[model samples]
Target: MMMRSKKIKLLSLAILSIGLSQNALAEDHWKLFLKNAYIDRDFDNDAVKDTGSWSQAISLFYDSKFQDTPIDQLQIGLDANVQYAVRLSNDKHAADSVLPFDAQSQKQASDYAKFGGAVKLKYKENVLKVGEIWSDSPVANIDASRQLVGTYLGGTLSSTVNDHLSLELGVLSKYSARNDDQFRKLSYTQNGNKIQSDGMSYIDLKYRVNDQLKAAYSFAHLENIFNKHYVGLEHNYALNADTQLNSKVRYFNVQDTGSIAAIDSQNIGVIETVKYKNHTVAAGVQKIVGDAFPALDGYIPELYFVNWNVTGFFKKNEQTYHFIYGYNFKDYVPGLNALVKYSYGEKIKLADGIENNESELNLIGAYNFQHDYLKGMGLQYLFAKYDTKYGNDFDENRFFVTYTKKF
Candidate 1:
C-alpha cells in the first residue's frame, strides 16, 4: 500500500511539473471530464443480493506535440482519472454482494485512481506507441461501459500499408480493470477459478473492398491459454437520399493452446439494419458452438454479436435472436434520442445437460443540452431486464449526468 501510494504521488508530481513548465501551451492541449452516476441492481436469486451505488468520476487528458523540436514527429500523451463510489444499499450478503466490496475489509470500496501515459512517434502514415493504451479490437478490447474505462500496458503499432489496407499489432503485458486502481497480469476465469497469463498479443487487419463494403480480420492470443480469430464483413447501401441500409456478418473461433488447454468455442452472427429518416430498426441472429465465450477474468471482451447486451448471450450451445428499434427526436426535440433492444437465447446447455433459456430487454434514452451554459452536458438513463430459466433474474437501472470541458 505504501509503495502504491508513493507511485501515485510521484505521478502526480510529474504531471504538475509538466503543466507548470508549459503553463500556457498545456491549457490548449488538456481536457477535463466529469460524471455523476447512480446505479441500482436487483436480483431475484438470494445468493446474489441487490446492490446500489452512487459514484462520481473525473478524468483528465493531455496531448503535447513536439512541433519545432528535434523530435518533431513525436508526441506525449497523459491520462488519469479519480473515482469514488458510495454504497446506497445492500442486502446484507457480503458473500454474494454485487457491489464493489473489498474482500479483505469485508466492506465496499469507495475510492479508486489510476495514472498512465504514452509516448507516440508518427512516421508518415504509421504510428508506434508504448505505454498505457485502450483498444476496441474484436479479439481484444477495453470495456468503457462503467464509470472508468479499462487499460492495458504495452506497445502498439498501426500502419497504413496502402489505400485499401491497414494493419495493427500490439502486445499487452498488464491490465487494469475498470474498477481497479492497479494493473495485474492478464487472466482467464472459469467456474470461479482464475488462470493468470504472462500477457496477450494480437494482430488486426482491415481492408476496404469498395466505397460501401469492408472486411476485417483479427488474431489474438492470451499466453498459455487460448487463441482467437475473428473475421467480419460490413456493407452499407444507400436506399435513397434519406434512407440507408447496413448489414454485417461476424464470426469467431477459439481454441486452447500451449500447456493450459482450457478453451474451445465458436461464435457467429449476422445482422441487418435499416435507417429511414428519424426511425431505425434492426434484427440479428447469433449462435455459440462447443462452449461458452470466455472473457479475460473481469474484463469485457469486444463481442460484437448483434445479441450482445449486458451479457454476451453466448452459453454452451446457445442460440440467440435479437431486435432493435430506435428513434431520433432531433426534429421535434433537439439533442434527444432513444432506443430499445430485446434479445432471446434458447437451448443453453449447462454442464449437467439441462437445457435452459435466457432473455433481456433494454431501454436507453439520452438528451444533450443545447443551451450554451450546458452545451457540453448530457443526461442519460438506461434500464434492463435480464431473465433466465434456471439462473438468477435481475433488473438494472442507471442514470448519469456528464459534462466535458476543454481548456
Candidate 2:
C-alpha cells in the first residue's frame, strides 16, 4: 500500500508540474474534469441487500507536442494524466459495499489516486504510442462510466494506407480498472475465481467506400482465452438540406481457445436514425447467440453493440430493442442538449432454463457555457433506472462539471 501511494504521489507531482509550467517550450494543452455520481440500488431477492454509493472524482490531463524535432516529418509527443476519486457521502458502509473496488478487498478502497503517461512518435501518416494507453475501438475500449477512467498498458501502431483506408494494431498486457490505483495482469472471472491471461493482441482495418458509406473489421485474441471478430458498416443519406438518415450494422463472433472453458457467443445489431434540424430519433435491435457475452477482467465497456445501456443487455439468447430521442437547444441556448434512451430485452437465458426479461431507461441533459467568461466550462446530469427479472434493480444519478484550457 505504501509503495503504491508513493508511486501515485510521484506521478501526480510530475504531471502537475508539466501542466502548470508556463514557460514550456513545446505546444502544450491541458484539461481538467470533475464528476460526482450516486446510486440507489434495490433487490427483488432479500438475500442480496440493497446498497448505494456517492463518489467524487478529479482528473487532469496534459499533452505536449514538440514543434521542433531532429528528424524531418517525425513528431514527438508526450501525454499524461492523473486521477483521484473518493467517497464523499457520509454513509461509509454503503459506499464501501457498492463502490468500484478490488473484488478481494474493500476496506482499502475508500480513496485512491492513479497516474499514466505515454510517449508518441508520429512520422508522416503513421503513429506509434508506447506506455499507458487510452483507447476506444470496437473490441477494446476504456470505461468512463464511473468517476475515473480505465486504462491499458501497451503499445499501438496506426497507419494510413491511403485516403480512404487505415489500419491499427496493438498488444496489451496489463490494465488498471476504473477505481484501481495500480495495474494488474489481464484476467477474467470464472466460477468466482480469477483466471489470468498472458496478454491480448488485436488488429483492425477501416475503409471508406464512398462519401456516404464506411466499413470496418477487427479481430482480437485474448491469449488462451478467446478470439473475437467484429465487422461493422455505416451509411448516411441526405434527404434534404435540413434532414438526414443514418444506418449501421454490426456483428461479433467469439470462440474459445487453448485450455480455457468454452466461451462462445455471437452478437448482431442494427440501428437507424433520422435527424431533422435540431431533433434526432433512433431505433435499434440486437441479439445475442450461444453463451453469454464474456468481458475482460476490469469491467470494460462493450460499446460496439446497439443495445448498450445501463444493463448492457448481453445475456445469452437475449434479444433487445432500443430507442433514443435527442434535441439540440443550440438555437435557444447555445451548447445545450438533452437525450432520452430506453432499452428492453427478452428471451434472456442464463444457466437456468427459464427465460427472463430486463429493461432500462435513461435521461440526460447537458449544457456548455458559451459566454466569454466561461467558454470552456460545461455541466451534465444523468438519470438511469435499470430493472431486471433475474438481477438487482438500480436507480442512479450522476453529475459532472468539466473545464478545458489550452496554452
Candidate 3:
C-alpha cells in the first residue's frame, strides 16, 4: 500500500507541474472540468457489504494544432490532459463495499491522478493518434459513466474511404477504466492468469445505404484472449413531419482463442421506436445463443437494445425484453424530459437444471437550465429497482447536477 501511495504521489506531482507549464503556454485557451457523483444503494438481507460511493473528479486539458509548411495537406496536433479524483466524505464507509475491489477500482477509490498525452496527425480524410488518447466507439469505449473518464495508451486511426464508407482501426495496449486508477493491460479480468499482455487490435467500417438506412461492422482480436464481431443495421421511416418510426438491429458473435475457449457466445437483438409529437415509445428484445453472453469487455455498456438499468441479461440461454416510454416537455417547458423503463429477463439456465428470472424498473427525470448564467447547468434524478430469483435484490437512487462554462 505504501509503495502504491508513493507512486501515485509522484505521478500527481509530475502531472501538476506539466499541466501548469501547459496552462502558461496556452494562456489564451485551456479546458477545465469538474464532476461529482454519488451512489446510494440498499441491498437485501443476504448482502453484507455496503453498495454506495461518492467520488469527485477534476481535469485540465490542452490541445493545439499546426500545419507543417513542407506538407501543406498534413496537420499535426498535440493533446494533453491531467485528471485526479478523490473519494468524498459521503462514501467513507465504502471500504466494505458489496463487491470486492478490482485492481483498478481499488486505486481509484482514493486520491489518485492520471496523465495522458497524445500526438495526432492528419492527411486529407485520414487521421491518426499515438500515445495516450480517448475513444468511445460502441464496441470498444472508455468507461465514463463514473467520476473519471476512461483513457487508453496506444494508437488509432480513422479514415473516410469514400462518400458512402468510413473505417476505424486501433491497436490499444493499456487503459484505466472509470473506477480504476493505475492503467492496466487491456484484457479480460476473469481470466485465470490475472496479468497477461492482452493487446487488442480492431477494425470498424460503416457504410451508408441511403439517407434513411445505414449499416456498420466491427471486428476485434484480443491477443490470445478472445475474438468478437458485431454487425448493426439502422433505418428510419418518416410517417409525417411530426411522426416517425425508427428501427435498429444488432448481432454479436464472440469466441475464445488460445488456451481458454470458454468465452464463446452470441446475441441477436432488435429495437423499434415510434415518435409522435412529444411522446416516444420503444420496445426491444434480445436472445442469448450458445453460452451466456460472456462479459468480454474493457467497459461494457449496453450495446444491445434490450439490456437495461441493472444487468444485461447475460446468463446462459437467457432471453430479455424491455420497454421504454419518454416524454419531452419541450413544447410546454423547454429542456425538460422524463423516461420510464421496465426490463425483464428469464430462461437463465443453472448448473442443477433450475431456471432464474430477473427484472428491473427505472424512473428518470432530467432538466436542463436555459437561463443566462445557468444555461449549461443540468439536474437529474434516477430511481431504480432490481429483483432476481437467484442473486441479491437491491434498490438504487442517484442524483446528478452539472454545469459547464467557457472563460
Candidate 4:
C-alpha cells in the first residue's frame, strides 16, 4: 500500500509541474486568516458529563494565474495553503464518558497541530489537479471547522466535453482527521491489529438541459473495500423577479466490494449476516421577499428515508429525516445571516426488539464587518440540541470570532 501511494503522489506531481510550466505566468495573490472558537456541551443523562473546549487556527494561502505564455489556448494556475491549530481548554473526563474508545483518544483530545498543501494545473477547458484537496459528495463531505482548513491527498481530472456536458475522475487516499504532511495511509486498529482500505477511485458526469434543469451521476469504488453510486436531479424556475423555485432530488446506494465480505463471523456473530440499504429525498423553496430583503437562503422541506449498511456505520439499518432554513440580510443588515435546521434518525430493528432513535436541532447567526481597516471580520454563534430515545439527550453551544485579509 505504501509503495502504491508513493507512486500515485509522484505521478500526480509530475503531471501538475509539466502542465503549469507550459502556461503563461501571471501575478501572485496571497491571503491570511485567523479564527477562534469555543464549545460547551451538556448532556441530560448524568452518565455523560458536560464538557468545554476551545480551538484556534491560522491559515495562509497563495494563488497565481498565468496570462502570457507560449500556449495560446491554455490557462494555468497554482494554489498553496497551510493551516495550524491548538486546543486552549480541556475536558478530558467529560469526553471519555460518551465518545467511542478510538475517537476519544484522537478527535476529542485537547490539543493537536496539522498542516498540508496542494498544487494544480489547468489548460483551457481541461484541468489536472494534485495535492491535498477538499472533496464532497452526497454520501460524504470533508468538513472543516468553520475556523480551520480541511484537505485530502489525491489527483483529479475535470473537463467539459461541450456546452452541455462535463466529466470528472479521480483517485484518492483515505481521509485524514487533520491535513498532515504524512503521505502514508493510516490504519484502524482492532484488537492490536491494523486495518486499511486498498484505495478509492471515482467518476462523475453532469448534463444540462436548456436553462432550467440539470442532472448528475457518480460512481465510486473503494478498491476491494466498497462501492457507492449516486444519481441526482435539479430544477429551477423563475417566479417573476422577486420569487423563484428550486428543487433537488438525490439517491445513493452502497455495497461491499467482491474482495470484502458483507459478514465477518470472526468479528461479530449473527449481526454480520445483515446487509444495509438506504434512500434519501429533499426539496426546498425560496422567496425574494422584495428588494428590501434581496436574498433568501431558502428552506429544506420535511422528508425521510431508510438506510441499510452493507459497508459502513455500526448499525445494519436506519431511518432519517432532515429540515432546514436559512436567510441572508443583504440590504437590511448588509452582512448578517440566520439559519435553523433539524435532523432525526434511528436504528431499525428486525425480529429483535432494539430501539435507538436520535434527533437534533441547530440554530446559527452570523455577522461580518465590512470596514477597510478590519475587513473580513466575522462573529458567529451556534446552538444545538440532541435527543436519543434509548440513549442520551445533549445540548451544545459554540461561539466564533474570525479575521481574514488577502493581498
Regions more than 4 Å wrong, model 1: 1-18, 21-28, 66-100
TM-scores of the candidates are: 0.91, 0.91, 0.88, 0.72
What lDDT does the true structure give each of the candidates? 0.79, 0.81, 0.75, 0.55
Better of 1 and 4 by TM-score: 1
Clashing pairs in 1: none
Best by lDDT: 2
Write candidate 2's Cα lDDT for 33-125 as tens digits. Answer: 766666555555677655666777777887776554898988888888878777776543433323454445434356677788999999988
State which candidate has the highest TM-score. Answer: 2
- lDDT, residue 283, candidate 3: 94
Error of 4 at 198 (Å): 2.4
**Candidate order by decreasing TM-score:** 2, 1, 3, 4
**1 or 2, greater by TM-score:** 2
* Residue-level lDDT for 122 in candidate 4: 69
**Total backbone clashes of candidate 1, pairs 3 or more residues apart or in separate chains:** 0
lDDT of 4 by residue, 1-407 (tens): 46435544554564455346434433477667788977777879887767656777666665666444577776666666655555566645444212111344444533333345556666778877777666664333453543354345787888999999998887777555432323445233333344455556788888997788998888877665456676777777765655556666655555555542342211010100111111112322211111111000111010111211111112334445555566777667878888676665555343357756666677889999876777789999989887766666778888999888876
- The C-alpha stretches of model 3 lying farther than 4 A from their native spots are 1-30, 90-108, 189-197, 297-299, 302-308
lDDT at 274, model 3: 96
